[model samples]
Target chain A: EPEVTQTPSHQVTQMGQEVILRCVPISNHLYFYWYRQILGQKVEFLVSFYNNEISEKSEIFDDQFSVERPDGSNFTLKIRSTKLEDSAMYFCASRGDPSTNIREKLFFGSGTQLSVL
Target chain B: LAKTTQPISMDSYEGQEVNITCSHNNIATNDYITWYQQFPSQGPRFIIQGYKTKVTNEVASLFIPADRKSSTLSLPRVSLSDTAVYYCLVGGLIKAAGNKLTFGGGTRVLVKP
Candidate 1:
């Protein structure tokens, strides 16, 4: 089974520095998403990307966050400036188009553990 | 999407079946019930999803009554490796860009010996 792959499984960055989390979604998948989970907290949606544009985003996806599909398979989430609160497990997920009857199962990557100090 | 309410935790034995129920009284007509499992520090893995009636997959079964206001995830003959956090989510009909899965506080299942 094809799986989503995220780079830099663990990242440690200084506060106020910029960080970019990289993900390669399934090759044939069309829709992409980013979610985060603080330690001991529920997973929270960050943003969704389709057709090279953001389709939806949550309140937490503020000015500091941006997602880009720089290539066919790469979906990247960039945080302009990092904060302590931004430390969490960031996950990337993708699903085939609904018309495919794939049931839209979000294939999530193992996730990147982000830590800001 | 309807907010889901579920037990915070459950305890089960190694050879027993475990049923974790979730309530989504305000589930919309277009919404579906989906469950995911997560281990410590890893992303959630899709378990099962159902619209109505009973749907069973290789790993678990989802039972949704006619009312669709609630659903139960049944894990039969669980083992110690089955210990993890189980999340129940109610979301709009999943599409290319419309499926935003909101995970609530998951039910932590502790499978004991």
Candidate 2:
């Protein structure tokens, strides 16, 4: 089965530095999403994207955060400045057409662990 | 968004049925109850989903009451490999509707030998 793929499984960056987490969602999926889980905490939604634009975002997704679909297959989450609290496992997910009478399940990538020191 | 509550942990024996229940008092009409499982060092995996009543798949079963205020995930003949954290989420399919799924403190099931 085709699955979502993310690059840089582990990323370490200095505090205040900018970082970009890249993901390639399932080839045929249309909707994409980004979520983060601080160590030992529940996963929190960051943002959702469709049609080259942001559909929804959480309070944690502020000016420092941005998402882009620079190409057909690449979906990226960019943090303008990283903080210690930003260190977490970032996951990228995608889902196929929900109108197809299916349950609209999300297929997630292995995840990229971001660490800001 | 509907907030969910579940037990912190559960213990099950191999070959026994395990049920994890979640309470969602504020679930809306359009919201769907969904369950996901996570193992160490991996992303959450979708297990089952339901709008109402009972829904079953090869992996698990979901039972929702008429009030839709609560739901239960049933795992049959659970084994040691079934040990993991299970999360319940309520949300919509609209990507723009702030459909961010809120994962509650999951129920960690430890299936013993």
Interface RMSD of 1: 1.5
Instruction: For candidate 2, write residues A55-74 as lDDT tens digits.
Output: 88989999999999999999
Give the per-residue lDDT digits (tens) of candidate 1, residues A17-48. 99999999999988899999998899999998
Q: Which ten residues in a row have the lowest lDDT in candidate 1 chain B?
A: B91-100
Runs in model 1 lying further than 4 Å from the true structure: A102-104
- How much lDDT does each candidate structure score? 0.91, 0.90
Query: Among these predicted structures, which one has the highest DockQ?
Result: 1
Steric clashes per prediction: 0, 0
For model 2, what is the alpha-carbon lDDT of residue A12?
Answer: 98
True contacts kept of each: 0.62, 0.52
Candidate 1 has an lDDT of 0.91
Clashing pairs in 2: none
